[model samples]
Target: MTKLVLAADHGGFELKEIIKKFLAELGGYAVKDIGAYSAESVDYPEYGHKAAAAVASGQAERGIIFCGTGIGISIAANKTAGIRAANCVSEYMAEMSRSHNDANILALGGRIVEPELAKKIVKIWLDTPFAGGRHERRVKQIG
Candidate 1:
């Protein structure tokens, strides 16, 4: 099973829960949730850092993080060394993030994306394989 870590701020708490359930229903993934457990105020950086650390440390193969607009949490995740976090609002972006950028972390906007659309993005991201070639050189440059 693939190991996945997830984190979200208060603004993303509900959507995180929904994603958790969706992942469960899909099966084949072992998920670890590093939370902002409730819909109360909480910082995106804390959760983003925790999830990024898990992936960077090899505890998880990938991570997903969330914030209001997805920007803040993605920025926070990207601050960690070895993490390529992509803030994706669409399936095409998700596909490209994984295939071209080799992103290890996906960031989503809880408020901006609908639940169904988010699910589609997640599926596409998970299913897409990194296309190594010229992309490998670019990814290495990022590192």
Candidate 2:
């Protein structure tokens, strides 16, 4: 099974819980959740860095992080070396991020995205394989 790490701030707590259940229903992944734990206020950067570190260290194949707009956490995740975190609001963006950028983390906006749409985006991001061709060169350039 693929190992996936998840992290989210207070703004994203509910969505994170929903995604966790969705992942469980999918039945092919082993998930590790590093959380804000509740809807209480917490800094997004802490969780983002934790998830990024897990993926960058090879403890997990990939990570998912969430914040209010998905921007702040993605920025935090990207601060970690070797972590390509993509903040995606659409399935197309998620597909392209994995296929082209080889994103190690998927960042979502709990406030901006609906639960069903988030599920679709996650499925697409996870299912898409990196199309390594000239894209490989581009991804290397990002390092």
TM-score for all models, in order of appearance: 0.99, 0.99
Expressed as tens digits, the lDDT of each residue in 1-143 for candidate 2 is 99999999998889999999999999999999999889999999999999999999999999999999899999999999999999999999999999999998999999999999999999999999999999999999998
Model 2's alpha-carbon lDDT is 0.96
lDDT of 1 by residue, 1-143 (tens): 99999999998888899999999999999999889889999989999899999999999999989889899999999999999999999999999999999999999999999999999999999999999999999999998
For each candidate in turn, give its C-alpha RMSD to the true structure in angstroms: 0.5, 0.5
| Model 2 regions more than 4 Å off | none
Q: Give candidate 1 misplaced runs (Cα > 4 Å).
A: none
